[model samples]
Target: MAKYLLLKHYRGAPAAVNDVPMDRWTPEELAAHVRYMNDFAARLEETGELVEHQALRPEGTFVRGDGEGRPPVTDGPFAETKDLIAGWTVIDVDSYERALELAGELSAAPGAGGEPINEWLEVRPFLTCLPTVIE
Candidate 1:
C-alpha cells in the first residue's frame, strides 16, 4: 500500500474553535465533538488503515537564503499567507483512487455540529523511497 498525505487547507481566517475556547462551548457540546474525533480515530485503527494523524501548530519559522554562512531567519504565525496548511494525515492505500476516497472521508471529520467544516484539504501522494547509487 502506498502512503498518502491528506493536508488541511484554509482559505479564510479560521474560526475561533480551538479547545482553549471552552468558555464559549457548553460542556456537553465539547464532549460530543471530542467523542466524535476519538471514535473516528479508533475506527480507523480497528480497520488497520490508520497510519498516523496530527494537528499542527500554526506557528512556524521561515528561513531565506542569504548567500552567506547563515541564512536569514524570521518569526512564525505567518500573517496573510495564502495556502496555509493546517493539519495532515498519513495513510497507506493501494491506489490513487483509493487515496482520493480516503481524502473525501477525512474532509468530513466531525466538527462542532456534527457537520463537515467545508474547508479544503490538499491530498498529496507520499514519496517513500531510498537513495540509490548506480555505477
Candidate 2:
C-alpha cells in the first residue's frame, strides 16, 4: 500500500473551470459544496481508503525561530504568498493509479449552478522511510 496527499489550494493554482470563487457562491451552493465534500470523505472512509482530511481557514500567520534568548518572530498573513493551501486529504491506496483516480473524483465536487467544479488538485506521494542497514 502507498500513502498520498491530496492538496487542495485556495490560490496559486490554475484557474478552475467553474471560475466562481467560493465566497461568491450562494448560501445553498456553499452548503451543497460542503455536503458533497463530506459525503465523499465518508465514502472513502467506508472503503478504508481515507486516512484523514481537513479544511483550512484563509487567515494565517508566519513565524520563524529567532536566536535562543529571543522569542520567535511573528509575521503577517502575507499578501504576496505564491500559494495558499485550502485543505488536504491523506489516503492510503493500493497504487498510484488508484490515488490519481480518487483525486479525479474529488475534483468533480459540485460548484455553482450545481455543476462539477472540475478543479485541479495536487497529488503527492509520501516518501518511504527505508530501513537502516548495519554492516
Candidate 3:
C-alpha cells in the first residue's frame, strides 16, 4: 500500500459551495462539523486506511537556521501568505483512485445546515524510500 497525504488548506483554495465561515455558523452547527470530521477519521481507522491525522493551529512563525551556536532567525506569520494548511490526514491506500475517493468523502463533510461543504482537499502521494526491483 502507498501512503498519501490529504491536505486541508485554510487559504489559497477555491471557495467552497457552503462558503459561510465557521465563525458565522451556529454553535450546534460548528459542533456537528467537528463531529463529522472526527467520525470520518474514525471510519478510516476502521477500514485500516488511516495512518495519522493532525490539525494545526493557524498561528505559526517562519524560521531559518542561523549557523551553528546561533539562535534561528524567526519571522512573523505573514498575513499576506497565499496558502495556509489547516490540517492533514495520512492514509495507506492500495491505489491513487482510492485516495481520491477518500479525499472526496472528506470534502463532503457536513457544514452549516448539515449540508455537504464541497470543500477541496489537496491530495499528494508519499515517496517511498525502499528500492524496487524491476521485473
After TM-score superposition, the amount by which residue 6's alpha carbon in candidate 3 deviates from its true location, in angstroms, is: 0.2
lDDT of 2 by residue, 1-135 (tens): 989999999888898898788888889999999998999999999999999999999888889999999999998888756588999999999999999999998999989888889898999999978744875
Ranking by TM-score: 3, 2, 1
lDDT of 1 by residue, 1-135 (tens): 788888775434355333233346557756766676677667777877788988877656676676678768666556777556667778787788987887776656545454554445677887779545675
lDDT of 3 by residue, 66-132 (tens): 9999999999888857588899999999999999999999999888888989898999999999868
lDDT per prediction?
A: 0.66, 0.91, 0.92
User: Taking the candidates one at a time, how many backbone clashes does each contain?
Assistant: 0, 0, 0
CA lDDT, candidate 2, residue 73: 97
Candidate 1 ranges with C-alpha deviation above 4 Å: 12-29, 65-68, 75-77, 130-135
Evaluated at residue 28, the lDDT of candidate 1 is 70
Cand. 2 TM to true fold: 0.91
Candidate 1 has a TM-score of: 0.69
Tell me the lDDT of model 1 at 68: 78
Q: After superposing candidate 3 on the true structure, give the runs of residues whose Cα lies further than 4 Å from its correct spot.
A: none
